[model samples]
Target: MKLIETIPENFEVQIQKITGDNFLKEKLESLGLYKGIKIKIIKNNKVDPLLVKVDNRRVSISKGLGLKIFVELL
Candidate 1:
């Protein structure tokens, strides 16, 4: 699995884990980010803050948080 932040833009991957404190986990879940789900890194490509597509929704996540979310490419 690779850290979400390091994954290049326009790539798709399946979420394997979300690691952090309980508060971070809860926050991610509330945003529809959990394990065994597909997500795509948007290609419009803004560094620092990243944009990820979760289901039909596009969520913006910080680099710090993205680094904690791991995924395996499909």
Candidate 2:
């Protein structure tokens, strides 16, 4: 598994774990992010918010949040 922040753009991955508090987990879940969900990285330039597609919806997440999300390449 690797931090979502470190994955290259266009890579598809399945969420494995979220290393953060309940508030963070809840926040992510509200955005359609949760364990076992497949997400595709639309953009990851390292200088801008990460853009990801989840269940046909596009979501922009911060680098900090990305660091807390562990995923396996798909």
- Per-candidate RMSD, Å: 1.7, 0.7
Q: Per-residue lDDT for 1-74 in model 2, tens only?
A: 99999899899999999988899889999999999999999999959999999989999998888889999999
Q: At residue 65, what lDDT does model 2 achieve?
A: 84
lDDT of 1 at 29: 87
Total clashes in model 1, counting residue pairs 3 or more apart in sequence or in different chains: 0
Question: Whole-model Cα lDDT per candidate?
Answer: 0.85, 0.94
lDDT of 1 by residue, 1-74 (tens): 88887778899999999998989888888999999989888842445588889988998888778878989998
Worst lDDT run of 10 residues, candidate 1, spans 41-50
Per-prediction count of colliding residue pairs?
0, 0
- For candidate 2, what is the TM-score? 0.95
TM-score of each: 0.89, 0.95
lDDT of 2 at 73: 98
Runs with alpha carbons beyond 4 Å of true place in candidate 1: 43-46
